[model samples]
Target: MNFKGILLFISLGSSFILSFFLYRQWSLTNWFDALFLIGLLLIMVYCVMVLIEGQFFTAFLKSTRNFFAKVNKKDQLIRESEKRSVEPLDYRKEFPNRSSFLQVGLFFCIGSLLISSALHYLN
Candidate 1:
């Protein structure tokens, strides 16, 4: 319905379509091309999803800053009890209510691709 949902739908559809075409091509030609194209498609979909959501960059920056702050604090040799006092990063706060459907679809596509490839190789 929304932009993210639309992108997810496009990505999932492309994954299925590409997998079908890649399998056909692999049967006729080579496996390397199919594998490369699969990887490329996955990367493209990932980039589009991440950029559209605009959270990856924000999460990365936040994690980096948190890491440095922890490192600096550790250098001060704080007590173990004090170390435990530092609050952990709350991923839920960063990206609340993230959809799992896209992840499930992506993983399903990847799993099918790998299983098919393995079967082909075994044969």
Candidate 2:
């Protein structure tokens, strides 16, 4: 599975585990309390998933660094392109798919938050 898929699985799994622990301590018998705990765990799960999968974000960043490491220095671009597999310097000239890492992540987070909030309200 991809990192995002792994992250999603980890997030859901950890939330359930935490909910289990809270269930035992606070209200083992009450279904509603258990459910509420589960719902609350979503925030924690997001936090943990972000922590663990931060490396993926780092990887994306490293890619961007590779991309920008050539910016304004076309002199070195040709040389750097020779050393790397991705040819980041050529990409800006050819494809120009210039989406920044932060913009992509902000989009993802906004989407995820919306979906999670909707699910919370529905549940």
In terms of TM-score, which candidate is strongest? 1
User: Candidate 2, which ten residues in sequence have the lowest lDDT sum?
Assistant: 90-99
lDDT of each: 0.54, 0.48
Candidate 1 on 9-113: residue-level lDDT in tens?
665556556656757543422343344454455555555565646655567767786677678856435646465444455443223324443454455456657
Candidate 2: Cα lDDT at 81: 72
Residue 117 C-alpha lDDT in model 2: 68
Provide the RMSD of all predictions against the true structure, rounded to 1 decimal.
10.0, 12.2
TM-score: model 1 vs. ground truth: 0.29
Tens-digit per-residue lDDT, 8-68, candidate 2: 4554455456556765553323333433444444445555455445444555666787767
lDDT of 2 at 103: 32
Lowest-scoring 10 consecutive residues by lDDT in candidate 1? 92-101
